[model samples]
Target: MSKSRIIGVILALLGVVLFSAKAVMVKLAYQYDVDAVSLLLLRMLFALPLYLVIAFVKRPKDPEVMKPKVYLWIIGLGVVGYYLASLFDFLGLQYIKASLERIILFVYPTIVLFISRIFFKKLITGSQVLAIGLTYVGVVLAFSLEFSLEGEGLFVGAGLIFLSAITYASYIAGSGWLIPKVGATVFTSYAMIVSCICVLVHYSLVGDFNLMNYGMEVYGLGFAMAVLSTVIPSYLVSYSIKMIGAPSFAVVASFGPISTILLASYFLGETMHWAQWVGTVLVLVGVFFVTKKD
Candidate 1:
């Protein structure tokens, strides 16, 4: 491989690992009795300044006037993808293990495929159909195991994460169209900033501001999540896609679940079953097939 290719692979792997660590960090933060919205608020709050800086810095020098519809599209994608998806993910993580959360969230690609088919009238190839089937089968297998282990909250947790996947899929589907128009850096930064504003608004309406009065450990975890999981990986994944292309990064990102599983085991003491292992493998395989270039 060429030097750029090697760096791209490394960046892709590192980005996936950092993104996977997000769940583990959230689980840790929950040890402080923070609600989902509050925790999410803390994360976005820290990330807000960074995104603001980038949004201003990287904005076009000679900005073209955009249609009002384009601004609406960016705002809508931001709400669905980051704000809602993240809220659901954090709530689900309250009841589910980080490992299972990662597994469930990893199915967003298949969800995106279906979203494209339904909304955009994109053709669903035979391989995509098979990929979708395999991905759900794995989720079912994993959900069953989690249900047996976690009992009551299993359905609720799984359901929330599934919702998260759907919302994220919608974001991906919309972003496919918008990113080309907006440019990746501007689209990402602006969308995240918009999402951050939505999160703040939501927190103000329903969340306790006192929830911000936590110990240093909780604050530290939130800071780490903002920098490591949210901001850094965002750029890293974008750069990796720029360097090696999205298809290759998608293939390499299959390792994300494994990284989460291992991190959960070490940090959260979450044990994995054989069924989970099998399910993880199936999901990754399904993703591999779906993400492979034509």
Candidate 2:
């Protein structure tokens, strides 16, 4: 690969590493007794202004792209990508094992491939096909090791996570059309701000939002999740999408489970089975194919 391509690949992988740490951090934050709603709200509270700042400064001085259709699409993207997708993920995490949930959500890349093809008529390459195939095999192996069907709730949670993955993948696949018009920095800022507002409105009506109820650890974890997981990684991936395109970027996302597994083992007192190791390797192989430069 050329140096520029190599650099793009490396930066994308770095984003994935940061992305992987998110679940670990979220689990750690929950240790402080914050409910998912409260924690998500807090993360959005902090993220809102940060995104607004980016949007304010980055927007150009020239004639702006201000058609109602564009704004409407942005709103739709925020609702599907940020609010609804995240809501499903957080809820799924409550009922399902983290590992199982991660496996389900990681299917986003495959979903992205199909969604992109249908909506944009983007053709999938041979490597992309192979990468997706390997990813599913890896997902099966990963689940075999950590499968949990503990309750009726597990099935519900799995469905939620699957929906979350599909919605998220659609957002990622479709956002490419918008990113060029708005640019990654500006597009991400608007998406986040809109997403934050949606979550805030939801939480205000349904969530407790009690300041005194949550301890410092909970609040602190919430902020950490906001900065590290949501804000930072989302921005990084936005930039990655701009730099490398969504199809390639989604390939790197194939490895999201690795982050959860390592984190679970370290902090949650969880153990990985032998099949998990095989799964992780298979996932890496898929990631390799997905990310391979043309």
Candidate 3:
């Protein structure tokens, strides 16, 4: 592997690690009695300033490139990608165990595969094909073992999470245009700013803000989610794509649940079941095969 690609992979892994902390923080947020929209609002609110600083420092001229068409795309991407996607994700999470939800959510790799192939006409190689298959099977194993046929709520939740994955995949694929041009920091900042707007508009419409009056702990966890989960990983993944390309980057991201599960075990008192461990191995192997630099 070239040095740059190696560095890119490292950055991507770091992004994954930052992302793994998301569930725990959300779990913590529940103790403070915040709903999803308000929690999301707070997160974006905290991360927006950071993104602005990064955007300004990294690339001032980038904002000038936000043409009218780009603005439309930005709105579409931000609303559907972040605001809606996040809404669906948290909704699904409420209905299922974190383990089950992560399993459903992480199938985003398969969504990315179809999106890249159908929209971008990116051809899949034999190894890439196997890697993709591994990705699916791995996700199924990870999630299915944790899955329960319990409530109608879980089924409904799974559907929403699947939708969340699709939207998130769209964000990943569509974001390529902006991330490379704007630089990771700047693009993330703007996209997040856009998300904050949509969320605020929705909050205003529902009068959810009146219910969202929060104390310090709520604000702290929300900000932590924004900075630790969204902002940091958003920039890191963009940087990874710039260096290693999206397919390779996404393949590495296929390993997201491993870190999440591990952290859950240590901090959340979750157990590491055998199936989850096997799924983690499969994800690592699939990522290795898919991302092996030629």
The stretch of ten residues in a row with the least summed lDDT in candidate 2 is 142-151
Work out the TM-score per prediction: 0.93, 0.87, 0.85
Tally clashing residue pairs in candidate 1: 0
- lDDT for 7 in candidate 2 is 65
Q: Candidate 2: deviation at residue 163, Å?
A: 1.5
Using lDDT as the measure, what is the rank order of every candidate, best first? 1, 2, 3
Question: For residues 51-117, could you state the per-residue lDDT of candidate 3 as single tens digits?
Answer: 6787567664645776778767777788778888887887676666565556667767667667878
| lDDT by residue (tens digit), candidate 2, 64-181 | 6756787888888988898888888877777766666676687776776678678868788988898889977986786664445455776777788889988898788668788888
lDDT (CA) per prediction: 0.86, 0.76, 0.74
* Top-lDDT structure, candidate number: 1
For model 3, state the Cα shift of residue 81 in Å. Answer: 2.6
Misplaced by over 4 Å in model 3 are 56-64, 125-134, 145-150, 280-294
On lDDT, who's better, 1 or 3?
Answer: 1
Which residue pairs show backbone clashes in model 3? none
Model 2 pairs in collision: none
lDDT of 3 at 147: 48
**Which structure among the candidates has the greatest TM-score?**
1
